[model samples]
Target: MNWKNIEGLDGVESPGLLVDSDKIQQNIDRMIEIVGGAEHVDRLFPHVKTHKMPEVTRMQVDAGITKFKAATLSEAQMAAGAGASEVLIAHQLVGPKLDRLATLIEDFPNTKFAVLTDDPQAADAINEKCGDADSPLDVYIDIDCGMHRTGIPLGARSDALRAHIDSLSGLNFAGLHVYDGHLHDPDLQQRTDKVKEILGKVALHEKEHPSPRIIVGGSPTFGIWAAETSWHLSPGTTLLWDFGYGDAHPDLPMTIAAALISRVISKPGEGKICIDLGHKSIAAEMPLEKRFQFPDLPDAQPIGQSEEHLVLQTANAASLHVGDIVIAIPRHICPTVALHSHATVVSGGRVTGDRWQVTARDR
Candidate 1:
C-alpha cells in the first residue's frame, strides 16, 4: 500500500485535510531515532504548531516526549491538556496574551509553561502577569541570529537583559532560544557549516553563563541541531512535513505525512480542469503555481485560484473527470492544515472515518 493512497477515500468529503496516522507515528519514531532514541527523548521539544492536534501531542507524550513548543496559547493549552510536562510558547506575549499566559500557567499547574522574550519591556510585562513568585513563569531569552524576525542578538545587551529578567520575582530566566528558520540550503554540509558558525557564538555565550537550558531551530535545521549535545530541539514540521521542506531537504528523512483532497468540479476546457481546491482550501501564501502539486498529475500547471475553485492546465486532464477526488501535497502544509477544522484520518492504508480534529488550528 502506498503511503499516499487512502483506502475508502471515495467517501471522504471534498476539499478536506488528509493525514496518515501510521505515517505520523512513523515520523515520531524517526524523530526519536534521529535524536538518539528513548534515552534522549527529553531533548525533543517538538513544536505542536504543525499538527495542532491533541492526538499527535498525546502520541508524542506516549512516546516519552514530555516537552513541547507552541506558537499560540491555544496550542499551548492543547499540549498541556495532552499531558505535556513542559510547554513553551516560542512567541513573545503582548497586550492580552500576557494575561492569557497567566491563565494557561494557572490552569495546567503540573505543566511548566515558558515564553520567549527579546524585549526587556516585554519580559517586565510578562513578569507582572505571572501571578506571583511561587509560580514564576519560565522565560527564555530569544537570541537573534541572522534571522532578525525575533530575538535579541547574543551580546552585552542580551547579557544585561538576562540579568534584569533574573531579577524579576515572577520570571525564571530559562535559557536561550535561537530560531534560525531563514537558513535553508539544499546541501546538508553547507547548512551544517553555517550552524557550526552560529554555534561558535552560542558556545562563547554558554561559556560565560551556564545552568539555564536552550532550544534551537525549526524542522529545516533540526538535523544540525540534533548533532549538537547542548541545544534542545523544537522542530515542528517533522510531524507532518509538506513539500516545501520535503523538497528542500531530502536528507532530513521525514515523510510527507499530510495532504489535501479536492474534487475535480469542472472540466473547463480541452486541457483545463478546475478543482474545488482554492486559496481557502490550500495555503495561497506561496505563488499560484507553487501552492500545490498533484502527485499523479505532477506536470499540472495551476493557472488561477479563487476562494472555492482552482483552475489547472494539464495534459493529464483528459484522463480526469468530474467528481474525481484529487489528492494534493501542499507546498506549505502548516497554513493549509489550519484551513480545515478536521482531517479524515488514514490508518493502515484505510480511511478510518475517524477524524483528527485540528484542535488548536487557528488559535
Candidate 2:
C-alpha cells in the first residue's frame, strides 16, 4: 500500500529482497540536490557497500558520480567494473589483499584506485607490494576523528605520516579520510556540531595548505559535509534508505527503496504465525527488537527465529492465512543485502522482471 509495495506479487518468491528502481534513482537525485545540485555531483564519492550491486553503481555513475568508496576489494572491483572513474578502498589492504589490489589495478586500468593508510610502516609495505612509479597507488592518510576503527589522529603524528608517505616514490599521497560513522545522534544539530568539532583541525589545515583533499562523514553526516564544498561526501546507507536511517532522519528526503518480502508459512500457535524470513534472510547483528519491522502489521513481535523461519506474535495472526504476504523493512540494509545473492527490481508499482546481482558481497 506504500512505497515498498509492488503491483504484482504472484511471481515474487517469499523471503526475497526487493528494490524500487525508481526510488533508487530518486534518492540519487536527492543526494545531488542535498549537496548543492547537478554541478556538485563530482563531490559525492558514494560508498557502494550498501547495495553492492553493479547495477546500482552504474546508476550512480550514470547520475554523474564517478568517484566511489568501498570497504572491500570486491566492492572496488564491482565499482570499477561498473564504470567508476576512481575508487577508494576505504579500508587498509594487508597480506594477500595487496596482491589482489595490484591485480585489480592491472585488470581495471581505466579506473584509478586508492587506499587508506594510517601507519607509515604499513604505507611502506603497501608501496613495496602494489605501488609503482608508472602507475602509483594513491594513498590517503586515514584520520580517526572519532571512529577509532582504523585511522591516526589529526596531529603531528599524522602530519609526519603524511610527510613519510609523500617521500615514498611509488605511492601518490592523497589526503585525509575521516569516517565519523560513530556519530549518529538523531538530533541534526548535535550531530552537525559534533562532526564539525572533530573536523575543526582538518578544516584549519585545509585553510593553510591548498591541495590535499578531505573525504569526510557517511549517511548520518551527509548534510553536514554537504554544506562544506571542500570536503568529499561518502555515504553508504543513503543509497537504499532503511528503516533504521529513515526513522532516525525523518527530515532527510530519502524514501524507503528496498523491502524484505515474506510469506506466512504456518500458524503454529494460537497467537503466532511463522514466516520464511529468518536469521539468514536479514541482518542479525542488531538486537532482536530492532532486527526488522512488519510495516503492515506494527504489532507483530518476533517470538522465534531460526535459519529459515521467523515466528511472530500478533493479534492479526488469526486473520493471516498461510501464504499471506508480509513486507519487512530491515533496520540495517547493508548487511541484509549481503545476505541475499540478488535483489528483485520493482518499477511502476510492479516487478520489472529484472534482478540485479549482488556482485560485491561474499568476498
Candidate 2 clash pair list: 7-349
Per-residue lDDT for 282 in model 2? 96
Whose lDDT is greatest here?
2
Q: How many collisions between residues are there in candidate 1?
A: 0
Which regions of candidate 1 deviate over 4 angstroms?
1-5
Which sections of candidate 2 miss by over 4 Å?
Answer: 1-5, 208-211
Error of 1 at 11 (Å): 1.0
Query: What does candidate 1 score on TM?
Result: 0.97
- What lDDT tens digits, residue by residue, belong to model 2 across residues 1-363? 363356777688878999998999999999999888998888899999999999999999999999999999999999999999999999988888899998999999899999999998999989999989876789998988877688988778888898898888899888888889799899988888897798677778767654468888899889878885557999888889898998898767898899999999999999899999999999999778799988888999988799999999999988999999989999999999999999999998999899999989967
Expressed as tens digits, the lDDT of each residue in 279-348 for candidate 1 is 9988899789888888878889988899999999999999999998888989988888888999888887
lDDT of 1 at 25: 94
